[model samples]
Structure formats: C-alpha cells, structure tokens
Target: MAKKKALTNVELCKGCRLCVGACPVGAIEALMQVNKKGYEIIRVDEDKCIGCGNCYTMCPDYVFSIEEV
Candidate 1:
C-alpha cells in the first residue's frame, strides 16, 4: 500500500494560519515568501504528515489536497 501525503495550493492560500495550528504533527509551516496575491504561503513536510486531514478540514481557502504517494 502506498503512503498518503498532503499537498498545498500556494495560490489559493490567504495566509490565515488556521491550517498551521490545526496540523497535528506540525508538518505545516509558514514561509517568508508570499504568493501572487501577496499572501504568505505555507509548506508541507510530506514526511511528517500523517494524512489526518486536519489541515483540510480547518482551512477556509481549501489549500490542502491529500493523495497517495
């Protein structure tokens, strides 16, 4: 069986940081970089993510997508 991971859509992110706090494993982190919309984006550590979908459920911008790796 393949492992699952979370992917991020940088363009859709509004830098709300809800997902950051919602992540159970601290896999998500805020970057100094900003998207085209001038909102700060987040990066996901695929190795640390457990596919719990916490970030997906918490984010209002729908930034996270889960897939098998």
Candidate 2:
C-alpha cells in the first residue's frame, strides 16, 4: 500500500476543476453541484491519489493535503 492524503471541502469547494486536471495519476473528478454559496465542489478517489500534491496546488479552496503520518 502507498501513502495517501486526505481531501475535504466537498461542499465548500469552488469547483475550479484544476485539481481534477492537475492530478497526474488522473485520480480526481469534478462534480456538478452548487455548494451552500452555490459554488461547485470536487471529489477525489482515494484509490487513485499518489500523494503527488498536484491537486493541492491547483485548488483554490484548500481542499486537499497530505498527512505525513
């Protein structure tokens, strides 16, 4: 098994879709739905993340990060 990071802000996310495209492993998916403020959100697949931090850099909502545990 490989080390995996935790992603959040499913509802608060702005859904820029950068993270989805930024994922080198092609692990991210952009969903179509409004948040509390009517902004789009992103969902990540745990099985696909390679802890590459590509999504973390492209995200404006601060939704993804790696835990060094």
Cα lDDT tens digits, model 2, 1-69, are 657675676765776787877888878877776789888777778787778787878778787777543
Candidate 1 per-residue lDDT over residues 38-67, each given as its tens digit: 999999998899988999999999899988
Q: Candidate 2: deviation at residue 19, Å?
A: 0.6
The lDDT, on a scale of 0 to 1, for candidate 2 is 0.75
Clash list (residue pairs), candidate 2: none
Q: Backbone clashes in each candidate structure, one number apiece? A: 0, 0
lDDT of each: 0.93, 0.75
Q: After superposition, how far is residue 59 of candidate 1 from its true place, in Å?
A: 0.7
lDDT, candidate 2, at 49: 70
Task: Give the TM-scores of the predictions, in the order they appear.
Answer: 0.94, 0.78
Model 2 residue 64 CA deviation in Å: 1.4
Best candidate (score: TM-score)? 1
